[model samples]
Target: MSSLNFNLQEMMTVAASRMLAADDVCFVGIGLPSAAANLARLTHAENIKLIYESGTLDTKPKTLPLSIGDGELSDTALSVISVPEMFRYWLQGGKIRTGFLGAAQVDRFANINTTVIGPYDAPKVRLPGAGGAPLIASHCQRVLITLRHSKRAFVEQLDFITSVGFYEGGNSREELGLRGQGPVMVITDLGILEPDPISRELVLTHLHPGVSVEQVITATGWPLKIDADLKTTPAPTAEELYLLRELNARTQEAYAPDGLST
Candidate 1:
């Protein structure tokens, strides 16, 4: 029996935020990653350095920014530099600690595809494509991905590899000269996945409270690995729920221009 006071999305966001440490220098993306990063900054990690690709360093936004280059990213930032400096002095220089990302598609090896759904030229749908994921995933000390679990999103092979996770797996990233550790954990709506040390394949390590391993397995496209001693993800604390709700309310307020309810 589990006490699920918060909604699944709330639990997922709070669960993702708890993974970050206060001292971490995080490369922020939009959506779930943004929510989780901001939640961490507000609750436990006040000193977390939030870096944006648009050169906003150490920003503290009360509401979620619409995009990487959103005005709030610079307005609330300690200092805003040029995009070149962000990529050169920060990302390539290895100053960023962890990359918080949201992927469109991922494989067993954690290789990501945010580019296209099908073939390169003739595709089902063209996606946003890789912006800074290639660099961030390769250069950051670690990475954390947030995405809803589904067979379509988690596949045996990615349609297009946009970021390097374990590459071919088992020291493949090391061989590729990637500076970072690649993806450390994948936080899904259902549970958490971590890489196997020997195989470098993602394995289900924990299921969210009230979630069954069978549900997660059904959502995955490939034959997923599960730990023999799997554990339940900690339910969101009262404080975590409050903080996340406040953040969400603030985001809604920011986007509601005409004072209409969001």
Candidate 2:
């Protein structure tokens, strides 16, 4: 790919990497979040602790696992425990530093809906229900969500609140006896979103290269905030792109060689 034709997935990876710090204990999900977390682990944040929901703690996989239950995740993990211990003793016990997740739908308050698109009794689209997301969102020190930008995915109100964000706003999480930073950042294909200062609602913080404010607004179902002097997300450097592609290629080779051949 040309420098100008930056891949959206790669951009999301870059954005996700920026959210992590060295030695962070990340509760990582599969797919794009996994890619970004692994990229961060291999690149700048070598000491980053990777925790999978399948009872793997501080896992150092050579490549991405196809899912939480992938044998490689266990093979390469530091240690594996019972699922209950993983959540009760480690995650909910305040051991996790960050929780990274992706969403099908996210609202202005950073509320996520990964379960359904319409009413509970009657339905439009029944999405995959939350696996460990609600607990992760509640217990992790902070959460980072990633998704592609579109009006359909970014709704005014989610059909089902699978994971809590601000949770009725105004420090209600604290009132409800939940601790941890709700959603620190949301990395999307269009831009980066952070909580609004006043409302604590998700607002556009920065736009990716070649993306316009109007484009972001058009894609969002609700009105989005824009800083007058918003800066564009820096294009991925050649080195960054090279590392990301190599990582992806290695993952493909390990998990789907036959799939790639076709």
Candidate 3:
């Protein structure tokens, strides 16, 4: 077969990778979020703490976990505790530095809908409702969301709000006395977004290399916001690409030894 294409999924992973810091305590979800967190840990930010919702704290698994409950998370964890204490003591108690999430749909206010597509009691698409997103969003020092941006995925209003973003608009999160950093960045396949200083609504800040503002607007379901001096997302550097590839190779080798070759 020809060389595999790295589509939006890969782009999402790349986007998520950039949000991590050198020693952030990240509450990571599975899928793209997991890939990004692991890539960051192996690459530029080796000391970043990985926490799973299953109560594993400061986990340092050599391989990518299959889920939050993956045995490897517990096996390699610094410590494990009951679910209640993990949330009440560590997360809600303000120990987590960041929460990495993925969304099916997000609105201008950044309110997320992982719950459903249509109505509440009756719905067109009943999605996987929030498991720990509400707590994660409310308690983490900050949040980073990764999603493929499209008219459908980036909507004017979410079908059901599973996690509060800016929470009704303009510093409302603080007004309501919600503790934590809130959403500092939203990473998409097309670009990076930050909330307006005044409105706290999501606005386009940087378009990825080869992506245009017009294309981003076209993909958004609502009237998108754009700053006067929007920048271009820097292309992945040689070092970044090399490290990411190596991380992927190691993860594949460890997780799929029989299926993946050296």
CA lDDT of each prediction against the hidden true structure: 0.91, 0.86, 0.84
TM-score of each: 0.96, 0.94, 0.90
lDDT comparison, 2 vs 3, better candidate:
2
Q: What is the lDDT of candidate 2?
A: 0.86
Tell me the tens digit of each residue's lDDT in model 1 across 189-259.
99999999988999999999888889999999999999988999989889999988998998898888665
Query: What lDDT does candidate 1 reach at residue 82?
Result: 95
Task: Write the residue-wise lDDT of candidate 3 on 11-70 in tens digits.
Answer: 567767978999888999887788899888877788999988898988887778767788
**Index of the highest-lDDT prediction:** 1
User: What TM-score does candidate 2 reach?
Assistant: 0.94
What is the per-residue lDDT of model 2 for residues 1-262, given as tens digits with 9 covering 90 to 100? 3557567778889878878998788999888789889988877899998999999888888878888878878888889999999889898899889999988899888888999887886889888899999999989999999888999999988889999988777677677787698898999988899887667878787888878789999999998888766778888877778878898898888865354445
| Regions of candidate 3 where Cα sits further than 4 Å from its true position | 1-8, 249-262
Stretches of candidate 1 off by over 4 Å are 1-3, 258-262
Rank the candidate models, highest TM-score first.
1, 2, 3
The true-structure Cα RMSD of candidate 1 reads 2.5
What's the count of clashing pairs in each model shown?
Answer: 0, 0, 0
